[model samples]
Target: MAVIDLSKLPFPDNDLEKFLDSVCETHELDFAAYAGMNPVTQTVHGFVNYPQEWQTHYVNQNYVNRDPTLLLAKRSIAPVDWQRLRQEPSFDMVFSDAHDFGISDQGLTIPVRGPFGDIGLFSVTRKCSAHDWALLKAKILGDLQQAAVHLHDHVIQSEALSSVLGPPALSAREIEILQWTAAGKSQQDTADILSISHRTIEVHLRSAREKLGALTTAQAIGRAISRGLIYPA
Candidate 1:
């Protein structure tokens, strides 16, 4: 499958809707949705490829506050399967209404942690049997995770959001180190290539992490890429 190049997207609502449609087509999913929280404003922004009525109904009812899928997924580091939430009361409260719209209960939500405490939830659903759902999920799990990050980064960096949350200012050396790390180079390897000591590389990485508000080097690299400081390698 061709990799979805979300960086090329313009981030308009229509474009995001089209992007979700394409994702659904590619993955054979019935629907796809992306919700992102702006940490500074504590406002929720998102788009979905579900039926228009369902979207309106979700908003009218203010289901975002009571939806177990969103609530449970927010607390989880891993993807939250809808199967696990079937027993929850909130699940019934939200999904019971969803059923009226022809939405499926079998789905998965991938949680993406961004710099600046932003969180993105990317969900995809399909109407399929248990065995088929398992096989399909196992096959596309990695791609879904990548899509989640790609969409989240683009959304958070878009013009609509840039004013509230500006990209971090990273130094040239810090960017260089992050670029190398994104390319899968180890600290010692980066040091060797840059003609610096490993300890110096570690310092630069630590500084980069601090600047990017990342808890770890991996997250720093992700944020750097999202901010256009580096490219995927």
Candidate 2:
């Protein structure tokens, strides 16, 4: 069976172009982009509607060091409204600089945790009425925010895992169950939280253990965490 295509909204195509177009159309936002920071490389990766020259200018000038969005994004554990960040002292320069690039006063950002300790961001950019942007932001709150970070982070994770760990055999649900198990949840507890049967929970765990080359669920959970297949609950 195919993985449930809950990846993004049921859009017309999987292409990022179509995906972002749908985002703009559906959300009534001006633009969307994913920004990734590689601390190791000291580089910022961004996908946006702006010109390449703009991106290059930011990069060449080493604006990452002073970018308000990047700074706010670094500390945020979840999506943040742009206005919430304008108060931070050093970001004033960034606020002034954003106008040069046409970043709107109103925006939303989804912070993503990438593989190998990288921090990534996905933002909806726009120059619009604050009230309209607020409404749009409210429409996508909780759901779209999680989806954005989840999809973006998972893309990077899948690529990194594909190269370093071959491929994971378990599905997302299986990974979820295994993660809960690692956190000391019982089969019954897992089933309750997952809304599945205890037997089903056991089945998922057993399958995960087999794929992870562990003789027991405990070993499987430990191995999964060590391998970055799971994280702290």
Candidate 3:
């Protein structure tokens, strides 16, 4: 088997409309939009850098709270198809919101949840023939979900998820060792807390340092604390 490189791959890291642009290239959609948000805060937080007028109008009117598509997506974990929503009278207000903002009535949104506390939506908007939109929606939903998931994971890790979760690192065993170490546990005590042996605890600690890329046990302790892997007393 080929070995996988542990080094980080360089991604765009931040580009608005990356997901939408990607889907547009492959699909018939004319506009691609993205929104990275804090679900708990009920704020858009960030979007794919749309026009200033669009942003200002969206915020000034508080459309998200009134957006039927967002409400449907949140209530259901699965991808909520726009065509399905359009037929529901409860969501007819969505059309009003779109019209108010001068947005196309045709669009699909995919919401993605990820580790380290990340959530976002990827959407494709089009003002095109009905047949074109049907084909575009069919071809693009799966890709939009994948892209949204990727961007969510990227945001959670890079954007200081200390507000929620953080740094998807280590394992339960590593955390047990680190906690004991922080409590001034001897290797013997660490092993005792974990019902293992001192040598085993040492192995766990060494593995944790390597896994956390910490040069010292103290550094490991600090890193774990900051990442919410271990709570401070």
**Candidate of highest TM-score:** 1
Record all residue pairs in model 3 with backbone atoms less than 3 Å apart, i.e. clashing.
none
User: What's the candidate order when arranged by decreasing TM-score?
Assistant: 1, 2, 3
Predictions in order: lDDT: 0.82, 0.67, 0.64
lDDT of 3 by residue, 1-233 (tens): 11111112234534434544665777766666655566444445445434557656766666666666665665556676677687667567556655676667777778776542445666667788888777866776765665666555554445444425544468888898898888888788777767887888887887787555454799889888987889874
- Model 3, residue 203: what's the lDDT? 78
Give the higher-TM-score candidate: 2 or 3.
Answer: 2
- Per-residue lDDT tens digits for candidate 1, residues 147-191, read 787677667777455646675678899989899999899999999
Tell how far residue 79 is off in model 2, in angstroms. 1.0
Error of 3 at 173 (Å): 19
Largest lDDT belongs to which candidate?
1
- Two-way TM-score contest, 1 vs 3, winner: 1
Off by over 4 Å in 3: 1-13, 17-20, 39-42, 87-94, 100-102, 116-118, 162-233
- Give candidate 1's whole-model lDDT: 0.82
Error of 2 at 160 (Å): 5.1
Q: What is the C-alpha RMSD of each candidate to the true structure, in Å?
A: 8.2, 10.9, 13.1
